[model samples]
Target chain A: MSITVRIPTVLRSATGGAATISATGSTIGEILAQLASDHPGVQPQLFNEDGTLHKFLNVYVNDDDVRYLGGLQAPVADGDEVTLLPAVAGGFA
Target chain B: MLTLTSEQRDAMVAHCIRNLPNEGCGLLVGSDDGVISQVVPSANVADSARVYEIEPKVLLRTFRAADDSGEVVAGCFHSHTHSDAYPSPTDIAQAPDPSWHYVLVSLRVTPPVLRSYRIVDGDVTEETVTIR
Candidate 1:
């Protein structure tokens, strides 16, 4: 199944100028794995030394916020979208 | 015009602080009345000098899903990695759809601080951010 994973500006370098990428997977974990397999640089940005998402980062299965659902195991189907948003911390200077 | 509950306020602060050194940004769901339901972190637009912009698709999805969830788009929350909790000229100029409670999360200072506001045209009014 094809799905779109939107990349936030902070993580754009890992994807090399791509704003969003399409990958294929049946489940959320599979999709994430595929994304990692496709973009080797993206792994550290999304996961930590423990292989878990950084506390400040969150992934949503079509904006449903996987944390509220089933987390990394959240299901995904063809045409579904996944957004990986890392919590931001900056403001007016 | 709205108030955040204790839990909602805390969640936002924690999310902001956890991402220190870089600008942390995110979208807050739940109506003004239900301000504690959703807090999805977003990108910082990669510029420390400008007001944060919610990612286009992420922004759309957050608000759209919130609408579908029967919740009003209350406002958006972002942090100040190294400044006071106040909106800047960029924030005032780029303020979209007036009803949003432009929540400013302060991470530069200790104990952390949060202030909510409504910036329209150029007026900035601070609102009490609380959770109940």
Candidate 2:
């Protein structure tokens, strides 16, 4: 199946400044691996030493959260959209 | 005294009340399966405090805690103590994330109205808010 992954603004720099990109995979993990392969610098930013999703990162399959669904093993059909959103820590005056 | 397990919800209301003078804000996470444990806050940003802004760092920390415990961004919430429990133009203009709900706890005293909404792309859709 094919899915599109959206990279939030904070991590855009690792993706050559691309906000959205596409890949093909059956599960969230596979799709992420493809994403990092497409954008070499994003792996370190997204995964930890053990290759698990960072504790501060959240991914949504369509409108549902993957953690609630199945975490990295969450399955995705063609045309699904993966939104990788990290916590925003900047303070507004 | 007979009581049910409404302590959390009640505490949320109380938190809103106590933080009423500074636009108190916070996030909620947890609940397996159906996506519950949402976030809400009552604003203390009175008419004169419009110039101030929420601390994103605080929100980020809450989000991190939620993520660590396997929670979605679920929703973002803030209070409308000075006005109705609805998204204002400024709220839309300043909305940073597009995937969460913006719960509003209006503390107008005369009549308290607590509401929830999904503000995405500048559009606000009211969600069902049951005080349970």
Candidate 3:
């Protein structure tokens, strides 16, 4: 299945400034893997050494957060749009 | 520099004040020139006075709207309940977009202080915030 991944501003450098890119996969993990493979710099940003989704990153397939859709195991279909956004978080402490 | 209308600035302060005790957060929608057209208040999903997280749904919706409007999610703002208007260590560590203006509102003072910064690769640089 072909999917479109929307690249956030911070990750644009890794994608050669492309705002959106196309990849093929049936699940979120596969799509991300293909993304990292195409853009090696994105690998470390998207996954941890243990291959878990980075805690600070949010992945959405369409409007649904993948975390609520079984995380990396979330299934996707052709023409699905996957968006990666850095969790906007911070504190005084 | 980050430029915002005075009313936009007040809206951010008001949202932070409304979420008192817990930190407030929001997204900034604007052009590439740093002129903010909208200040979108969001729920601090973290719900902690010391920290904040922009609700995911808000983020998604803001991004979609910006995409459709030809504007961009230029940056974001959050409140510092007890500290000064500066990027905290947590803010630096989690600074997502280097091109984004990281705005902070310090409610510790009367008439809450608002400031903006550019955090890149963990380095924080204070920027001028123009509220007209």
Candidate 4:
């Protein structure tokens, strides 16, 4: 299955400034792994040393957050859109 | 410089006030020239007085809208209920987009204060905000 991954501005450097790219996978995890393989710079940004999704990065497959959709194991169909947005969070702490 | 209409600036301040006790957050949609065309207020899903997270759904919709409209998601704004209009340490650490204009609104005083900055590689540099 081919999926479209929308890269956020922060991660553009990893994709050579491309805002969106296409990768093939049947699951979110596989697609992300393919992305990391294609763009080594994105591996550290998307995953932690233990291979878990970065806590602050939000990944959505077709408008629904993957965290609520079985995380990276979430199934995806061909043409599914994946979006990566870093958590826009901060405070006066 | 970040250019906003007077109404857009006021809308941001009003949204922050409405979400009192918790930080208010929103996305800025604009053209490539840094002139904001829309001030999209969103629920601070974090729901904390000390922190904020723009609702993910809102963000997705905004990105789609901007793409459809040939605009861009320029940046975002958040209100600081107790501190000055500056990016806190946590803000610096969580700065998501280096190209984005991080706008902070300080409500520590009676009248809110708004400031814009470009946070690149953990460095914060204030930018001029022109309200027309």
Candidate 5:
């Protein structure tokens, strides 16, 4: 299945400054794996040494967080759009 | 540049001040060009003077309201109880959208200082704020 992956600005360098890219996979995990293979620079930013998604990054499929939809195992199909967001820590005293 | 009306600016400051010792958080809604149409104040679940978390339910409701009004989530605003009106390291790391205008309100001064910023790829750049 083909889908659109929205790359956050922090990871745009890996995609040669392209804000969005197309990938093919039956599941979210597979699509991410393909992205990593295509843009090696983004692999470290998205995945940990243990291959798990970084805790700080939040993935959403069509606006709904993936954490609520089975995480990396979430299913995907043609035309699906995935967005990545990083958790912020501010308001420090 | 981000434009905010005087009332809008005051609303933000009031929300932050009302929270007092606890940090306040909210989302800004408007056009993508940095025109703030609304300041949707939200609950700070963190309940800490040094931290904040926008209540999810409030966020969802605000988002829906903005959607219905044809406004986008232009950016976010939060208060720094004792720090300067600037984007902290954690704010830089968590900026999800490069297009957003991150507004920081510091209550440390007698007259709270408000600042606007844009965070892209961990780079923090101050934006012009026009309060009319």
Candidate 6:
């Protein structure tokens, strides 16, 4: 299955400034692995040494969060769009 | 420069003020050029005086409204209850769209201060806020 991954601004450097990229994978985990292989610079930002998605990174398949859709094991199909967003917190000092 | 109408600016300020000790957050809707046409006051689901989380239901509704109105989600707006109108490190790290404007309102001073910024690759650059 072909999936399009929307790259967030913070991780764009890894993709050579590309806003989106397409890769082949049957599941979200496979797609991410292929993406990391294609752009090694993003591996550290997307996953930890334990090979799991970083705590602050939130992945969404279309409009549904992957965490609610079986996470890495979530099945992916052709023309699926995945977005990565970082969890942000800021307010009063 | 980011352009905002006086009424929209005032409404945003009022929303922040109404939130009191808690930080207020909302979405800025407009076209791709940073001309904000609407201020979508969203609920701060974080419920903490020091943090703000946009309510998901409200967010969905806001996006739908923007779509129905032929506007794009251009930026984010939030208030700092007791801090400067600047983006914190967390904000920088979480900035998802390089093309988006980050509008901040600070209620720390007698008159609330408002600022706009573009955060790209961990860099924060302040932009001019043109009130029309």
For B1-132, candidate 5 gives per-residue lDDT tens digits of 999999999999999999988988888999979999889898887789887777655555565577688887788899998889988777776676788899999999989999999898899999999986
Clashing pairs in 3: none
Scored by lDDT, the top model is: 3
Evaluate residue A19 in candidate 5 and report its C-alpha lDDT on the 0 to 100 scale: 77
Fnat by candidate, in order: 0.23, 0.00, 0.83, 0.87, 0.42, 0.40
For B17-114, candidate 1 gives per-residue lDDT tens digits of 66566666777777656355777777655544344556545765765587578785566888877778898776665555356678887777888888
Ranked by TM-score, the better of candidates 2 and 6 is 6
Docking class of 3: high
Question: TM-score of the A chain in candidate 4?
Answer: 0.94
The TM-scores that each candidate's chain B achieves against the reference are: 0.85, 0.71, 0.98, 0.98, 0.95, 0.94
Per-residue lDDT tens digits for candidate 1, residues A21-84, read 9988777778777877888887876677787665556677875777666766788888998887
Candidate 1 lDDT: 0.70
| CA lDDT of each prediction against the hidden true structure | 0.70, 0.62, 0.93, 0.93, 0.82, 0.81
Model 3: TM-score for chain B: 0.98
**By TM-score, who's the top model here?**
3
Candidate achieving higher DockQ, 3 or 5: 3
Segments in model 2 whose C-alpha atoms lie over 4 Å from true places: A1-93, B1-6, B31-34, B38-48
lDDT of 2: 0.62
Write the residue-wise lDDT of candidate 6 on A2-63 in tens digits: 78898866688889999889989888899889989999998987898999887666677777
Once all C-alphas are superposed, what RMSD does model 6 give against the true structure?
Answer: 3.7
Each candidate's chain A: what TM-score?
0.85, 0.88, 0.96, 0.94, 0.91, 0.91
Where does model 4 exceed 4 Å of error?
none
Model 1 CA deviation exceeding 4 Å by range: A1-93, B32-34, B47-51
State candidate 1's DockQ: 0.11
Q: Is candidate 1 or candidate 2 better by lDDT?
A: 1
lDDT per residue for candidate 3 within A22-88, as digits (tens), equals 9998999999999999999999999999999999998999999999999999999999999999899
